[model samples]
Target: MSTDTRAAAPEVRISGIDPHWWRQAAVYQIYPRSFADADGNGIGDLQGIITRVPYLAQLGIDAVWLSPFYPSALADGGYDVDDYRDVDPKIGTLEEFDQMVAALHAEGIRVVVDIVPNHSSDRHEWFRQALAAEPGSPERERYIFRDGTGPEGAEPPTDWTSIFGGPAWTRVPDGQWYLHLFAPEQPDFNWANPEVRADFLKTLRFWSDRGVDGFRIDVAHALTKDLTDPLPSEAELDAIPRDAGQHPIWDRDEVHEIYAEWRRVFDSYDPPRTAVAEAWVERHRRPRYASAEGLGQAFEFDLLTQEFDAAAFKDVVVDSLSLAAESGSSSTWVLSNHDVVRHATRYGLPPLPETVGTTEQDRKQGAAWVLAGAPEDQLDREKGERRARAATLFELALPGSAYLYQGEELGLHEVGDIPDEARQDPTFFRSPGVDKGRDGCRVPLPWSSTGLTFGFGSSSAHLPQPQWFADYAVEAQERVDGSTLEMYRAALHLRRELQTDETLEWIETGRDDVLAFRRPGGWVTVTNFGEDDAALPSGEVLLASSPLVGGRLPGATTVWLRESQS
Candidate 1:
């Protein structure tokens, strides 16, 4: 660590003393089912994570964000929680979870667990009780239950569609319908109900008391809904301005009050537990979720959907920093997660239109090409890997926190060929041919180059792993110099040493395809997105994503430079 402590702003020093340690931390997301399997059960468990705590600490990440490990029905990939307070037996027991937390804490790493408050699994005790209860009862009031809108109550109450694809409302035996924003197995909670609010606060305190460091709130923005009689239709929602608190079922003002109450629970902790919202609201509404009085940080998801273009990358970076400054919170950068295609493979596909994911045609094409597997001839794998490397360097150099998904360190690509019979994502079943769902990115990671499932476990993995995964296995990449795994390790180690105050100054080169910026600590980062080489700034070369072209920065490359000692 550098002894020079002087800084212009509240610097993100890699020290345990900093209360706001997450500001510049690198968090690694570990999907429990795909990360590692310790019990030969073809599923990654808390015990497996315990065995790999040394690996996480060695990766130089400050925190590990574990996806939902709660008892679930496996609907929507664990987003449908059956219990808020216990670990799923298929993954591990509560004692094993505590052991995993202790192991991580012993290694100087923080533990952040996922909290799914928006909905619960249909098998959840409360949901089951609600199902058995009669209409207009207090149990039913805990969820969004309404009478049908048509003759003989035969139609859905609203025109809203489930995110997994289908009607959001599911009719029960009592001739009443309940709302589920995701799959039918996951019912949305009635946030207006005091029981829902009180229960979530208890969940927060439960994990915090167990020494959990932070939380990743699933579906953070869509919790509170304005269930006015004669609810707004899809067309009516489209006509409404995209402002906070205006929409009927999304980004309403009441959502913030929930977060406000949760923030109080967070503050009650010793160092004050932190949280990040997985909200997909517009950039303008993002700050509301990220406010210090709320969830503390909101995921900047625009970067994940963007093409590997210099101009587009720069725009999102600038916009995120500005928003973070206004909100008095740090911004988050994540390229890939369990929900989307891995960037390593995504960058290889053809560029999407400017308004990506906004149109039905674009989304359908994306699912077909990116998720359903485009022909091998259409993909430029080598090019995509190179861009992926450059993008990681660019993202790590930015001001705030960075999130790395599991298997990304080894440069893993999407496993798009999982047989339909083995597919488990609800999106696949719900949407049929329209969407392939997210199982491609959630495949078990390859730890070694040998074995039937690339050493994922004693038995085959729950999701099949391509044989080519052997090439990018952690064991193989560890030995190869300049591999993606090594590059990530070096970047993370260097980031702590070279980082300065939370400041980003644009370095103008008068080139549209080049993006150059300097931090206050004489550290400079340059990324070239054109077909031509670009000149490097005057500084000592610290690291490069790829080899330089005759000492010039090559296209689709990123380089880190530091002020040379005279």
Candidate 2:
């Protein structure tokens, strides 16, 4: 396994167990626009997040991963960044950002900011300059600008499809088509340009100098595209085995060299800032992104896509651990994030057929279901919450980092009936309503149940919140016994003590619907996925996702036990 050569931060008192705290840290993700709003402008801001630092501290997370707070027009929910070096005025000024970081640090919670190197807003200064500059100019070279293929340049340069469901190329006023893998307003950067490389290096140092702990690299795999003279057709690209080699626009071999250079910058600091890649590469190739010489960790997202099956979850954990071992780094466990359906809602949905091969496709299917306005009658909220709680405990017991999205602790479900006009995700408009997009999960959080917007802000929330959100609000859950929020607090508090090291050994139960694993320090975690309760191994009960009946773990429940010394 690869080792971190940099010295650990002695001043950091947050989980002094590992010099690289990220390895076992329970990091919470904050989608800024939906987290909290202090300005009472009906939007979440940096000041709003600063106000919630205590809430996070009590949540027992070691770190907070903030989604893009950079300047943006909300073209793509802040992913379409307009500036890399400054904060958006709508949220708060850079000073407020510094204050937010300080507040988090005071609570011993490290901060990880988002870095979108894959693309920039069409309104970004560089893109603006490129639009005004002559063809083949250095300004144009910073992005992928090319001549169209058909007569009078009417057709796009390639038959590439945007991930949002349209032509990937957009024709400029000058008749040249620019490449955008996602939205037309978000143009892909030409990583081959030295200016692009140097600018990102500068952006890294800027944040690192500001005392930010790390970065979450967005769309991390597509930074370096193989821009050959003759690009491969979509059909040709699809036929190639994913593991065979590099593709033209995703997971190219050259991407590692850029990361190696970035590693040097990451290691330059005394304690050395860290980063995790949101890479969606194949399992075998994923280790490269997690390599010690490159990005330190790769998000093991298969867990997020899973349907809470014992065998499937076990397989994911085993493969994730193996990949982390190969990369000499720790895996990251996440059940939900800003880009997908909440696990509480997902657990209630029917499992994808065996024919579905990828997590991306699985997520797309989930989104399509939501867009189709599937009736709430189909959702088993009781079963979903039970399975969600069990899954959270199962994820926490694993031998790696754990990431929790905002509002998950309260067992929030996706709001499927969001009014069409209120929808903001580019996916909805780009897909032309074929996909409802991520607005359901991005709805502003409900802090209290008394107000119309559930105390999100003084005014209405940007997206309409369902009245049922009051049932899951923090205020309501805190007052109730055995609520999802209370259970999460209990589980997280126990996790810090029970999670000892990066080691997990399967304890065969000789049953198909059960999963049992032993961690270091004699800490054991068991989950019952069968239709009926299952007998537990002999151990002292430390924590349980639900109340144990006759010392048995109920179906769709997980428990943690400590083996007593003889």
Candidate 3:
């Protein structure tokens, strides 16, 4: 799908994929805070993202998931919204956003943004009005209102903790109690109210009309809270976004009705829009089983948990596919996103840099091994290589859609240094040591090597581009054939070539280390996770880490093979 072809399509609906195109699509998640910064404001913005669209297109991704950019106080890294309709002045103007959208569409790449419906910035007029006790205000009803009279005007209802690791209830500047599941600045919306659902629909329409294809809906499960049943009823929802076990105490029945209504709204449009839920539903739950009738997709969070073991991983995959999908119902993927630590970091890579202190080629070989096998010590350099390779291959090999974090392909490690003064994420400030906060992993992308800015420009990139990663800047990697950037490009381009058509369907070839699957057009992706050449039984290996015998894989590599067409 190229820009010229997409633009020339006959239907005014902007066609290509059924609303579910994202299922087969490989989506790259960008923390705008860490993407390229065009204006050197030491922060990432819509313009900055515009500058990097080509970078993503070249990366061979079908779509990009951007974190929220609504007008905000920058609390919770733009998740707390002051105004849903306008772009944050710090990020860029709405006009720039329009151009970015058109530019993305022109490039044949769809744009999906993070829409936070669960809560809004307390600074928003609605919250302010509520705080002022405005007469007959609709805003007051939008958020949950408890009179503290349940069990004899005493005993605060439930004792669930806020996601930032504090009491979920915050005393409003007014004399009442307001709820903030994440940040004090953010007040959770009362989904129990119809007006909340209606306003949310309006918010969706605003962006869709502005050219956004859809949204990734953040803290999606939290939209529906069990304020009555001791705060929540599920282990997963109780775990918070950063923690594991995302069962849905908050993912309830009415959500299906809301999704169904939204789907009807989408049908009103020509091409039809896509809507993805962030929480998981039971195998027989309405959102997962009856999803086709209402929403386009429901996110599967099994990957975000401690279910990193191979068998557990496989179970999640099988379960996800079996659940919402009968034949063509949409199935979502969850490997990595902005809120979680980069996969490269999570799979137990050394907390610090591994490839350093050695020659680039030597480091490449070491990384290959690390990516291929689980580590004796997750932080060991010997294992980082195999794990990196395996993780990358596995993500690409998944049946449903996939998400790539900004620095993962670069084999980037989690940033360890956080100057106390510079740590902006409320999670750290609010939780203390219970959570280190997401600041390090979400810092600005360094594009230059001259110094700290990673070659993105200067120290003034949109959000403090890390000085450490700056040395591994994009240009530096582009110049080096074996750099992380090139590897990512190769892997991505290879995936594009393998999945030439729409869907990715494959059979498990009965091997743990060797993950073999077939693409829609009879092409198979066979991966070998070892230090020596691994053989493929049926087809000739097309792509390899090092030149393979049958283009076979030696030294932890993935080979694309296509059986002859009948």
- In model 3, which regions exceed 4 Å deviation? 1-20, 134-138, 149-156, 226-249, 280-290, 304-310, 350-378, 461-467, 500-512, 529-533, 545-556, 564-566
Taking the tens digit of each residue's C-alpha lDDT, what string does model 1 give over 1-566? 01122222211222364668888889999999999999999988888899888878878898999999988879778888888888889999877877788778877788899998888999988889998999999999999999998898989988888777889999999899999988999999999999889888878877787778899998888898888897878678667865757788778888899999999999997688999998877768889899999999999887887888988899989999999998999879999888878898889888764455723235445655575446456678898899999999999999899999999998888877788999999888987876777898899999899998787888889899999999999999885788999899999999988776789999997899999999877889999988799998888888999998778999989999996756
How close to the true structure is residue 87 of candidate 1, measured as C-alpha lDDT?
81
What overall lDDT, based on C-alpha atoms, would model 3 receive against the true structure? 0.63
User: Model 2 clash pairs?
Assistant: none
lDDT of 2 by residue, 396-449 (tens): 999899999999999999888888899998888978757888999999999998
What's the CA RMSD for each of the models? 6.1, 4.1, 7.9
Give the lDDT ranking, best first: 2, 1, 3
C-alpha lDDT of residue 302 in model 1: 75
Candidate 3 Cα RMSD after full superposition onto the native fold (Å): 7.9
Which structure among the candidates has the greatest TM-score? 2
Candidate 3 lDDT over 245-329, as tens digits, reads: 2333355655566777778876676557776766543444524423666667766656554323545555666666776556355
Q: In what order do the candidates fall by TM-score, top score first?
A: 2, 1, 3
Which numbered prediction scores highest in lDDT against the true structure?
Answer: 2
Candidate 2 regions off by >4 Å? 1-18, 359-362, 370-374
What TM-score fits each model?
0.95, 0.96, 0.82
